[model samples]
Target: MSAPFDLARQRFLTRCTVVSLPKPSPGAPPPSVVYYMHRDCRVQDNWAMVRASQLAREHSVPLKVFYPLFPSFGNMSSRQYSFQLAGLAAVEAELRELRVAFHLDHSSPPAAAVPAFAAAHGAIAVVTDHLPLRLLRSTNAAVAAELDALPGPVPLIQVDAANVVPVWEASGKREVGARTLRPKIGKLYGRFLTQFPPVPKMPAGSPLPPPTDWSAARAALKVAQVPDAPGLTAGTAAGMAHFRGFCETRLKKYAAVRNDPNEDAQSGMSPWVRFGQVGFQRLALDARKLGKHGEGVAAFIEEGVVRRELSDNFCFYNEEYDNLKGAAGWARESLELHNKDKREYTYTLAQFEKGETHDDLWNAAQLQLVGEGRMHGFMRMYWAKKILEWTESAEQALEWGLLLNDKYAMDGSCPNGYVGVAWSVMGTHDMGWKERDVFGKIRFMNYAGCKRKFQIEPFVSRYPPAAENCRKAGGEVALAPGVKAGKKKQKKA
Candidate 1:
């Protein structure tokens, strides 16, 4: 007899492409199932959890959630670590309440840690979340291979639960830009945008395994490696509170002041979004319900939902997302033509990391990221473009930008970050502007240009200079030769 599957269950299963396993080796342990990848750390509105639960009920097997803590994954810093751990602590608490076992295993690579945990728990299959980043991709593949080679056949399921429209459903081919993807996303928006019903109530099952120790987890973290940032509170409760505050006050003016560095008009939800403390679907639905008739609501939704999801579509479909080699043909050609152009000033990776750039505005932007784990969305573009002008090559600029971004920005390690870097450094998903040196015809941003547009003094004043020497050597510093320094330092001491 086959297992009973409902309409909702069948609909979700059909969306995910399944990989068939080869026949098991004789005398091998039978496959035990579990979930291993992508921290979709929410209990409610998570397709991965829902699907995993359905399978568990059908098979009458114990289900568990496995998260591996790999410190060496990337340039993760103290700030990022604190934010992730805080959110996971909340998730662990939520999972305990749901009566599902949550396990945290420390290992160098998740592939090794996950399978071992599954085996210990007597899992028959493994369901993991799909992530577009190379590190996670390789980790998932490694785990799948390990399971394949096991003595018994273990089915591995990869779930696409991050985006509103699954990456495959959005587009099979890489989209050209927002314009191309916007319409395609719009046509199907109504279909997939519905709220995910709660994970179907299960009968009283075995109590969860021992909960992870939050205090020990904190003590064990390598604090020296992570960056320090302020104004960020971790966990789902805090995330929801922040979202509510944004919708109440900032959403009204988001359209008008989202670009202003000084105004807190933007939804400060990226940290939460990054860790899945709050799923994108929940936020989108709440925003839609709250701002049904207003332009502010519409604009915020466009950016938060439509545009942001489009980023996932880009990274998921394109392997070259991490490099300039993946840029549009015109952008690549233009950059190469200007490769020989003399740079006004060049800085090394160390100098850039230390915030030693000659441009005060640029340094201020960098300080914001280092100090707060974020910079204004508008400033991030200017931030990357300036790096292009001041570096030896576009490739070098990309490297520095991504390192600084992922290391400092709490919202780093996301498709949006990759897309932002590509758009600024290589002109992917963007159109060229008037020709300029170093940047060629690609879009350019300069300190003087920004100064002309806003109250530079106040914006600069927000972040004081990092170094005492830089502060003592006051007065506006010129980024290019022959330009005059202002009497007042761009930022206060």
Candidate 2:
């Protein structure tokens, strides 16, 4: 079996497409197949599942969904773990309804878990969704390599369902900015923006695998130590409900107020999109149909599809995306030039995590993420660029930002998060701006800028400054800056 054939050639005509991988000799039973891992987690509107089912139907094989759970990864937090498990539970139920088996590999990497499961099930061809992250990408590649090394051929097909316009179809080279990529995405939108076909029903196989036990799965997550934040639900049903509400009400004024944190004008759909609970293509289709809100819909689509896909493109093609070394030449040169500039203040990663910086707006932005697992998009830029300004090094700023983001944010550990941090810290997806300390010619964001744009009092009031005694405690209670430092003590006393 060869590498997964590119299925984008079939366009969006059908939810599924056949990948003509090299077949085994005649008279052999059809392959028992599984999809390795990736973004299209949902059964409905998932091209990978569609393609996998199509293959199963074509070869008269049994199809199953395999998602491996390794609790040791760096970015796997309790919050993320809980979110994924809940979503997978939903996926398990959905797949069961379709009479397909779903397996949970809790002990090993996908390479070990998936192939072993496939071999056990007598799977001949395995199809997985494409992802841009280093670990997952390597995992899929390794799985394919291992399968090839086996005695008989076991084809692995990778489907691109995360992006509205396929990543490859968007552009061959990295886009310089949204402006450059906007028209390219606009041109191709019509071709890819279409409704998701209902998940085709397959004949019931004899008593499909047992549904994943959500309780057991949650208990098994032994990764990072962060306590779970409350009120963060996960599932495709929730994602679709949120999307429908946004399209019906918020899409009208999205262009006007998306940047206003207080308005909550932006569609809080990134976490859903990141988790692949809702299809990007589906969002694009609905946005186009919004006649009265066309401008707003277009604006939202630009960020949701074009800008979002560009992040995947960057991470996919460039291994160094998470570092300052991957920044544009202009940003690199400018940052080096200002390496010795005087700084008003310097904050350690710990201080930043606690939202301890002098700026209230920055703290508010940090609070939004830490407290709620999300931040307003505009505030995210302000939050990260300030890290570059206040940190010891550009590299340190990037490190701290990425660390904090992945640890706390629900939508973190994504291409958008990496590119966003880089863009804020090192100007990767942006151009030169007015020269400034720490940042030099790279984009600069200031408390005054945020103050000018939105009402800060409400935000500041929302996350009150930490108390001194609590701050000094240096535990969960010490997570806030003002509390640890006794800054809030004077006012309270």
Candidate 3:
């Protein structure tokens, strides 16, 4: 492959997986190179797309980007579809400027869609981005199978464009935690973290895939009930601008106030990053350049690269990623030990969805997730742990947690969401803690701990429980605001 385009190919051939290599066909007009935009959706800073462009240039073939759009993706609704399509609209525009054709295939299953599209387009090679999630992985496998079955088979290649360090290269097995995976990525980051080369403009002539029919696309969506987030704009440009704003203003305080829900200290880039509108490597590279915010930069790297990639590593290596089966042996045993324990509070999925839980803080967090499409990072830990506390079994808890997260959060259905919920309920990457009644050995989080960490009232006040929820919680809603647990003012006798 001409000594592999750059350092990425040189250091770790694992960065790209060669599924099938078809022999060159005798033809006059060279075949096209297909870049299937899946996990990483951006125009630039995407290794998968870059590699496809390189292959097209080398083979003297036209370059094309195809996104197989399903009417519905998992539990995703209009909220997610709107954001995704908006970003894709930008992708079409950018690819047009670069003179590359962008095709939107509204096929039911991408596995079928991708190979059929390649065959129809006379593709010589198909390059795509990697996603560890089961659906995408299965789709990749099925596509590879279909490609191999074709009369004139073409090579199928995958690039790990999502993570700063490729998941497979980072670790071969499911890592126990960030501690185990951090060093492995640290050793390899120098080689993989280098700046991405531009995806050179393709020679003109191939018609730009008609400007995406976004309205028709939206109208065709099967899941359109969920409302889109209020102020969240979707596009690489907006995502980059958000990151720049964070670096300029919020980054300095990120280290200190990130845990405080009341502070707007988060990077707020998850929706963009998760949707592949922005790349993690880009975030890390940009953050590393801000030496002035050293502490924040370090913390950001810990979260963005080490922690985030750790989630990817977990999902990629562990087949049972979203359930109790994926938990550590000790964690599984501990959860099993506590499975029969009585719960002081148990709420149905409907109640949980409505934020009708007794704890106002938990209710507020749930409200934030439903209303804003995300919850505070600190609160998410408390939120999921409480599910384990209130649900019937560890299994049910994991189920409910995943359901809610996948249904609500903009970044839901990704490895990070799976790992986050697993960490909270099943202790996937966390160690067993001191045994407790409902939680057993898994890490425990409570309202009091949150109160100690941040001003609970300000955050809770922002998303107050509905009056009906307050009534259901036995009128404790008034006590939640600014009042510490166990110190609520006693009613006058």
Go through the candidates in order and give the clash count of each.
Answer: 10, 8, 0
What TM-score would each prediction reach against the true structure? Answer: 0.87, 0.88, 0.92
Local distance difference test, each candidate: 0.73, 0.74, 0.82
For candidate 1, the lDDT comes to 0.73
lDDT of 3 at 218: 79
lDDT of 2 by residue, 194-313 (tens): 666565667766457766766766677776767666666789899888888888888778999888887867888887888888777777776676667878887887788878988987
Residue lDDT tens for model 1, 1-493: 2122222222222222342333456654443347674657777767777678777766766567888886644666777887887778777787777677788776346778876776566566788766677787777777767766654546577667777666677777888888888888788677767777566445565666677876766666664465556767888788899999988888888888788887888998888888777788778788888834388877877886677877887787887887877888889889988877899778888777767766666777888887778889988988899889989888888888888999899988788888999899999888988888888778888767776666565666566673322344343543333546556546421
Best by TM-score: 3
- In angstroms, the error of model 3 at 312 is 0.6
Indicate the worst ten consecutive residues by lDDT in candidate 3. 10-19
TM value for model 1: 0.87
Question: Residue 487's C-alpha lDDT in candidate 1?
Answer: 60
- For model 3, residues 382-433, the per-residue Cα lDDT tens digits are 9999999999999999999988888889888888889999999988877778
